[model samples]
Target chain A: MSNLEQKPFNVREIREEFPALRQQVYGKNLIYFDNGATSQKPKLVLDAINLFYSKENANIHRGVHYLSQRATTDYEAARQRIQRYLGARKSEEIIFTKGTTDSINLVAFSFGSTLSAGDEILISAMEHHSNIVPWQMLCERQGCVLKVVPINQRGELIMDEFDQLLSKKTKLVSITHISNTLGTINPVKEIIQKAHAVGAKVLIDGAQSIQHMHINVKELDCDFYVFSSHKVFGPTGIGVLYGKEDILYRMPPYQGGGDMIARVTFERTTYNELPFKFEAGTPHIAGGICLGKAFEFLETIDMEAAERHERELAKYAEDMLDTFEGLQIIGEAKNKTSVVSFSVKGIHPFDIGTLLDKQGIAVRTGHHCTQPLMDFYGIPGTVRASFAFYNTKQEIDTFVEAVERSLSMLK
Target chain B: MNLIEKQEEIIQEFEVFDDWMEKYEYIIDLGKDLPKITETNKTEDRLIEGCQSRVWLDSNFRDGKMHFTADSDAIITKGIIGLLIRVLDGEEPKSIATADLFFISKIGLQEHLSPTRANGLLGMVKRLKLEAIKHISAS
Candidate 1:
């Protein structure tokens, strides 16, 4: 069925599923617009967390007992569920990680070990520090070159510049699918194709994209995709790293520990198979199982409606905020998601954020870990209000009124 | 007034405001009344690291008293620094070094200036006392 023809979903009903949305903060109704930082947990996700610890608590993978076998089954089932979620060919390609940061670091260390001095890694200007630092450390250790593809004033990646940066020397092109700060939906599919033409691998950071839109690894043809569970309305400290099986087979194991090994010997220790080889130690069992529950919750929602609702909330906020004098919206890309970042003239973003917090409106302030992007804009930071499917137009109105009050007080 | 007496006085003043809004307005007013530090004094040596806001503190020791001048990029943080300066400035280095400045919690500003605030009020206080220690030893 076409996206426009999808069945309508009740946003108010969806809002009720998230318990955090029904609360008062500082004598005002809490308007949480910081979904870009981390989404609020639904009741199902919360229950799953409790159930795992209460009823199904045990170490996974190697236990032959009932609880161990049950835990192992649940954990592996989570991997399979995530595999289907991302449309990967096999469940073995999904490697459980601590988070997106841990996942990227795994690739940087494992895949980076194969590189020599002259190999280059190309990243975008708007990458989070997680994506940037690991590659920089790799460059420092292996003497590889780290090049950044710059963005335009609208926060969109410069495709021509990306094409220029691509070459045989470009061993990998690591970029974010959506900018957390800018909310710019990057042309990652096109980027993947272009990078592939030069025989370069592409790693898409889906930390912001996984929850907002549909993701298909096979359709995108990306070599690697990484995202955090917390950002996708799941438990923290668990993430997924999807790598092509052939490429993963070539890379070395990330950490040396119990589960990632086949046999331990005095001289030589044989590593385990594909996914477990990278996952070291006893993993976050509860986090893994609850992540499956998160996906199950996601499966119940009309995702197309959720996406449209989020976009509508953002546009409503943006339009209202634009009417306020001296307010300039940052990252005005043609294609964007549910994030509105703005700055008022002659007022600091911190001041606005503080005032907004006092009014029970939770928006993010400062550079948001994208200091380089802030430098490009020639500002210290912007106040950002990011939306989720559960957010409403009434909340946007409340937020805009709060912003107006804050601007008046500050100005 | 003595340091403890001054802190108690500030706490009593804050007690008049029942709502956080009024209290924050009072703090913002205090921020507005703060004396701006001279541009030359905003050197790297005078800057406090690990603050979310940029805070520059300058001190001079005269007649065994430590005179402090400070400024912050954020207003609320400036007000906090103002409160710190009010209780400690012009005191003897020994007194400044040992003063507890207990009014922060009494006035319900513990969250804003606590060690975990990340706005670096705790670090600023530590640096101020360290300066006092240096002055006391020098004297």
Candidate 2:
């Protein structure tokens, strides 16, 4: 068999890695296309979760007992793994968070609360609600201005417009490295460089990017980076925020409570060191520990090979769907991850999604949380099918067949 | 109106929805009859943060009744807002507080909304109730 056709890395072997992928949805073999929303967990991640609870379930950081020490070791080791996964310089730079939303909010409230009036925060038109809302709330509170860099018809960021939006007054430029709605992989390195030249911090939202691409934070030189663990085949309710050592040290604590404090008295208190300064209260301990297993699982795969395989499938799915009358694919970015958003003429996206679900070929239908992009396109929503490495060619074929069948019903 | 009376009013309003959908050419027409927000009153302060549609919301209390005027950039979303206004508009704070707008899942209106849109709708309802709570407490 040819490399792509070979079962070497096909769904059968890949399916074994993910316990959730074996189940049936609606009496049909579940074809999960919601990877962009959150990926299904692998066996390793699940085992890690089970293993943590079975052996080491105590609260982290404080107890001198065996369970607490082991738990602290596992949690910090997970942080170290993620640090290496993202190629961060130190483990101290990584802060465990609830997810990308929490990570962004942490930065906004902690870092953004310090900004002065007339300071500008630049973001793109295609940001998810999580990325957009936190900055807006910060702007409203801090008297800082929020500027948007527009995207072109193809859903790619207009570099000129982004350059135009950057200035000395810009305090931060937070942009999605890969759009969840559109599959566009942005030029984040250049975006970061331009922002940094003006003395502004840059936070790249990697909620969608981490799955498809290999990210090296040091190479990118982004001041801050955030991504949800769930999107990377890890457990939900856990994520990581990576900041440069200098910047993280200067930023204030996000939540004030236990574990984050170094010295506490009725009169005064001092915050803990680098990462724990931000991590307050009891965190999603099991989730954070399992996040390491997710990185380990991803490390085993040939990332380039997977990317090429999915790109080919995406293109094939695109061509097949294009054969249908009046079907338009949105966001045809030249460089993209494995996501396809499309709409059929004279049909609501929800109708198409419901029809697809009946056949067990799941897909997301709607704005995909980028409403400004939807408004720009003048459509109510688009049906989005996002692929992961484990997704098969046969699944794409089934998806196309289902789409055709669904369209016929609309007729 | 009392609890039983409000439930009856809701049942009647749902019955009128079919007729409203047919008679009105656009969702905004339904909105036009529900309430109004004068142009001079438009501000960024009233803009909802996360909605994909440009939803303009303005509220005022007149004679113990809360009035809301909302307009969306999209038609279906507008229709949804119209449905919300019909259910939520003009009701007293405590009565509107007890109303289950999520019950639209039973009527199958939310069947069409994506999870995100549904969440947005929920957020809008929460904002409306928050406004009501503000006024109710002030009084």
Candidate 3:
């Protein structure tokens, strides 16, 4: 029963699970290094999608019909699956959302109402726009102060600065577990403990970390955790917001609609309980069910070994790319993940990205939804090649060569 | 040469380059020949912001003809701009606005027309047509 994968983590066999990997683009084998944006779904998740639409297509809850009951059962089962996956104590803590952005917006609108003027919400410099913009909107509405924790040149959060920023006035600390652009693995456990000492709730954006490693919310003991299913090889438009039971109960309902209401009356209406109170509209039933299947696919793999493989890929890529004369790796964090982002001295990232695309390497070249981080680095954007466990060292070799060729062309 | 003759000439030139690499090398050369707008004209107002690259377009209406001088931070995008300006410039506003731009596809560079393309050739084409429309409506 040890999923330590004693068989030594066969990536070739693992790559077979994803049909997308067995494809050609631009007359060459496709090299997908854009896992930071979204991951390709395994056949298990894909089949679940087909099964849901073909047979299990029905609106969940409130329906006494056979299909509706079946759908409701499947949908609730998915929530429980996610709850157990995150090591959440109760299923009531899991709230299905549109994605990570929607989950953050939900907390911003519902829990944000609890804060008054001059209350501070602390966030880090490397947070995606999804994490930053919602809190900014919350601040704008409530006159709350937005305090930013700065990062070092290496893209690691300055713990000293974070310590100085955390205070009684700080109501919340929302930070990313991993930077999407820089691949910096933030120390969220330390952050959570520090934030809690000052009576501040911490929301860890797990959009980057969930698929890469084993996440136990009970162990982390954070107030809230949010991630997109799409980034975790699940269906798009469905995500999970894991909040502490007590905190979720204290926050008001996000949207008033069918599923979220316990009772509806023009004169007086009562809201639903726990997780249902936050889930307002008719949910993406297929997406919810298929995401559970995505979790099932993940369970079959040894995530620890996979994480090791990804880290090795990052190291190999970084070491190879560092040799170029004018090329500078954007983030040099000691503890990082699978992303290797770099900028050439004079060449624009866009031009390099274009040539790479023609060579059948799918890379992301832009600010990567971290404009403030880009501003801090004093660069317009970077060419980011993010790796997954299925990616081989051979592919990195090809990718490095492509980068070299592209840089030569651009220069 | 008229717009049609010039497009045929460019298409013929691209036809010789059998491979994408050769085509790109030629385009990179073409980028060097792009009629660049001066730094003063490269203001925020002239910027056509793309998802990846930045483009600046300078439009002038002279003698009933539409003249465009544009620049892009990315050389590939600049070369594409060069191609657009080659056929459209010196043509009347009405002709330029309605000109069927078939050469981009004929030259096997239609991928740039995709909205997802970082160079934002689709946006450039739209801005170019928009420039033409401005002069057409004025008259």
Candidate 4:
């Protein structure tokens, strides 16, 4: 079916799917603009959570009992669901972790431990601490050098610089596919191609990318892609680390415990196969099961249309914020997701955020765990208002009005 | 070590947090009371990196308990740092280990904090806990 031929998503029907959207905060209908951090759960996802605990709440790959068998089936089914969602060739490529932070740490410990001294790991300056810190730790321990590809004033990566950084010593090229702070959509396909030209492995931090638009891992051909479930309208405590089978098979287990082992002996223990090798302890069963439903919920929507709507909202937000005197938008990327970052000249970002919260509009104000990016901009922090498809133009209007009210206080 | 006694003590202190305006007013006043750190202590090494406000924390462990003296460039932040020292400074290493500091919710401070400031508080607490953990492990 053609992408245009697809039916438009029913916003009311979709809004009904998320019960939390109907909530009242401070006697006003809650305006949730924090979708970049973590999205609200849909009814299907929340219901799946309840259903799993009520019916099939048993540990996977353990017992011959009916519940255990059922649980194992559901759990593996969730992996397959994710595989289809990301367009991965095989389900075995998916390794579930706590969140994006845990997934990055796994790669750092498992694959990064193999990197020797003088090896270089290249990452972009726009990466979240989750993406940057793990590699920093690896560099510190292994003596592997850490290098960053710089971004321009508009928050876009300098492609030529990134190419120059990728050389024989470059072991890995890890970068965020979409910058959380700046809303800059990076060229991952081009990045992967250039990195591979030098025989370097590439890992795309999809924590911000997955929600903005559709992704096909097979098409990108990156060595690995990582994302958090909570950011994609699923529950917390679960994330996916998607790597090609051969790569995953070569990597060592991150954490050793009950489930990750194939055989246990005081003398020599054998590790479990593929994905199980990475996932240790009793898994987040309910969270994993609900995440399958969240993926299903997203799949039913018209992603391209949703992307267009978000872009429209972002443009409107930007135009509105531009009118204020001494107000500067932090990232003016021509291509962006639904995030708007700005700083007021005289007022502190915290004071602006606090004043906005009085009008029941929640916005994030800080370095956003991107300290290096903040330093690059030479600003303390920016007030960030991120939008989702479910958000409306009216809400944007409300947001702008609140900013005007906040400006009066500053003056 | 008695669970009930500890719970009662925590609860008693926790109740005073109502009317955050009043509590924060008192806290800001307390911050005002602090003698500002000398210019020599305000170097890059003293600055806590993740904080929204410039917080300088220096500690002395006396008789097996950690004593932290902290100040921030922002007034309310300085007050909160002072409150943190009052709650955390004299506690045993193990007591600090098992502490349910998420009770920032119960005390209504969590709601008052901008997510960033809440994150700052969390970072502050985490740093303090790590110091206690280090002390416990070394001993």
Candidate 5:
């Protein structure tokens, strides 16, 4: 069905699905704006967690028992669900991981071995440490050159610089789809096409983008896409790494363990198939299942409306905050998501965060794991208010007032 | 005043503030009043590690007592360091090392000791006591 033909998103009803929103902190209703760090779990995801532990508790894949078979089915079904979610070609392309960090490390170690000295891996300046460090380690190991595509003052990537950086020596282009700190929605489709034209693969970090908007790997035609489940209203400790079938089949196994091996003898051990080869040991079975439930929850809502609601909330907060003297919004990207990071002229972000916490408002304050981005702005950190669809305009009003009050106390 | 008496004084002072805002205001005032650390002592070696905010602490042993001068990038963290120095600055190495710091909880600043804050207050306390221990062993 067309997005317009689908049921319109109801914020009030959506808010009801998350039990965490009904709580009070410091004698005031909690205003959660830390969705960038991790989103609050909905009832369906919670129920899936409980149901897996209560009824379907068993080891997967190897066991022939009833509960074991049920668990394996659920686990594999979760992979298929994620496959459909990302519009991946095959279930084998969706490899369950511990989180985004682990998934990136897997690719760095496995796909990275294919690279030799003098080969280049290109990444943007606005990448999270998770996306940056793994490639650094890969470069250090393989003696490869790591090239950085710098961003402009507005936190948008300089496509001209990226074009200059792309060359035959460029083995891979790993970049974030949406920056967690700046909320800048990067042009990954263009980046992927450009990278492929230069005989280079691209890995899109979807940790921030998966929650904010729809993503189809086939449409983007990225070599790899990675995201954590927790950031998308699912449980922690489980994530997905969606790689192209041909690329994954060619890459070596990440970890050695019982599940990842097809045949093991004292002399030699042969690895398992496409997805299993990457997945080592007993996985986060319950977390994977519940992550599937998180996608199911998203299916019930009109994502277009949710995306619009989040953007409006961010714009509303940004406009109100701009009116205050000495308040500088860090990122002013033309294409952005729901994250609004700012810093007061003279006041430290920590003090503002402390006072806002006392007022029962939750906002993330610091470099936000983007220390390089902070350095680019010539600041220590920023106070970031990230919105979700469940958040209301009323909450934004309360937040702005709290920030003003906090600034008054700080100044 | 003795260390315990000093802590009691702080508790009494905080009790006057009925809300977190007033308490925080008092802390900010304390931060403003903190004695500036010398430029030479603000070296990289003097900087305390594992805190959310950058804190530099330096110590001197004089007349069998430990003198601590500290500063922080964040004002609230600076205030917290001031509170620590206020109680332990002039005490003997043994006393400074052994004395329990009860003023933190009494002033409702226990949240600063949380893991999310990276247990920065506890790290500061540990560093201070370690300095005291070094002084005790040196002389």
Candidate 6:
């Protein structure tokens, strides 16, 4: 009542808010367990997307017309919403791009442009391909060495190894806040402190963490944070890159066209200010508004309760699956999120995933775009059943039962 | 039986399953029955690309017939691979190259028919046809 907060954390009530969950696949109710890859959109965000297209569809920031002004207001307001959501210093700190991969590439190119030959960029072994490849490309271009912090069998980053890797020569330390495949929550706060000590800036890939936890860039003191709108219950093709205002001012424009310019001429060009310096072209205007609506939707939830429920789901699934003789849970970090990734001794994850899909219990299979992590475990892939707050234990029961049946058929 | 007859046989076999689980279980059994490619034959050159599961298909032409042996890491994929080989194997090279795989859809397995499906059935079929063309040109 006080602030339009969503009713207290009730899974049943919250489930009603998402319309996608009420569908059937193969005559069975769909049990979507792919939150790590992307979350299902809520009705509020869906309506916002439709409303923008139906009524407020116009190119933003340039036109003085009523429609453009309304679109610009909503878009800028969305930027501010993201800023407030992340506890970023100003709306100027939030720049929208085409999802997390684009966000990482922006930092890699712009911030990477600042680095010189022989300077090092440190990342962990568990990062998604987006985080790894961008830096690798940067290292190739700039002649900067890319060092990876190794992880234990439990899939946790070896902090001591990271400490050894972080030195004066290290220019940046980019790591994931949570492993999308393993659900291991990295100690990004400590990593930020250590990186700052060694005078290296840090970027936390919050593509997986933002939806599951509370993030305050000011408190975390990270140089940059990136996430995708689709992974946070918003529309696809849009994401955020939250960088410190000071750092963003120093970096050059990523793409040099359209909105990202201050003034353009035949002779010379000047880049735009803060966020606009990075955002080029029209951008996904509808996605921006809907993502803002998503953050507003997120405001209503009790994240702590939601997090606890998700953790319980993971634990409950893990315990149940462990009973099977050859099933091995991949990421067993003490501090993990609601992701249960497991491999059976003789079964390929693709087989399990295929059968699960036939039964309408959706899960992810294969390398999950982290082939190196898969190689670390000496397995091709694992069947990953990642959970969101809306998922319940009963669904877990069906999934476990389906796994058992699938195993029986495979065997 | 000819290629079309074999495909029709598969469709008829699948028609009796009232639910998907029973159908997939039958596929799993067929996968188990498929003669696996030799470890040496499962070389890099034999592996099909664009499949989520590793699929190694070995082809040979003898007695004017195109023979195919396949293996997959996943049982379900192997089952589907078995179904493909069932339709395409033991046929003349010309017939193998021109065969219509309409039964894949008829068997309620339309999901695997797309060129975009990561299981690479379409890719495997393409490879099988290419092998057939090679044999046909040689003759």
Judging by TM-score against the true structure, name the best candidate. Answer: 6
In the range A293-351, model 5's lDDT, one tens digit per residue, is 88888877788889998999999999999999999998889999999999999788888
For each candidate in turn, the TM-score is: 0.97, 0.77, 0.96, 0.80, 0.97, 0.98
- CAPRI grade, predicted model 1: medium
Looking at model 2, residue A331 earns an lDDT score of 88
- How many clashes does the backbone of model 2 have? 0
Worst 10 residues of 2 chain A by lDDT: A1-10
**Candidate 6 per-residue C-alpha lDDT over B1-139 given as tens digits, one digit per residue, 9 for 90 to 100:** 8888898898888889999899999999989898888888889999986546778888888899988888987788889998988788789999988888899888888787577568767778889999999999999
Give the lowest summed-lDDT range of ten residues in model 5 chain A.
A1-10
> Clashing pairs in model 6?
A262-A272
The residue-by-residue lDDT of candidate 6 on A1-411, one tens digit each, is 113566679999889999999999999999999988899999989998888889999999899999999999989988988898899989999999998899999999999999999999999999899999999999999999999999999999999999998999999999999999999999999999999998999999999999998899999999999999999999999999999999999998888889988888999999888789898899899999999989988999999899999999999999999999899999999999999999999898888998999999999998999999999999988999999999999999999999999998888
The DockQ value obtained for model 5 is 0.61
Query: Where does candidate 6 stray beyond 4 Å?
Result: A1-3
Candidate 3: lDDT over CA atoms?
0.90
The numbered model that scores best in DockQ is 6
Docking class of 5: medium
Candidate 4 local lDDT, A117-206, one digit each (tens): 999999999999988889999999999999999999999999999978889999999999999999999988999998899989999999
What TM-score does each prediction get for chain A alone?
Answer: 0.97, 0.97, 0.98, 0.97, 0.98, 0.99
Q: What are the Cα lDDT values of the candidates?
A: 0.89, 0.81, 0.90, 0.82, 0.90, 0.91
State the DockQ of every prediction: 0.52, 0.07, 0.69, 0.11, 0.61, 0.76
**Pairs of residues clashing in candidate 2:** none
The C-alpha stretches of model 4 lying farther than 4 A from their native spots are: A1-7, B1-50, B55-139
In model 1 chain B, the worst 10-residue window by lDDT is B46-55
- The residue ranges of model 1 lying beyond 4 angstroms of the native Cα positions read A1-8
Expressed as tens digits, the lDDT of each residue in A137-186 for candidate 1 is 99999999999999999899998998888999999999999999999999
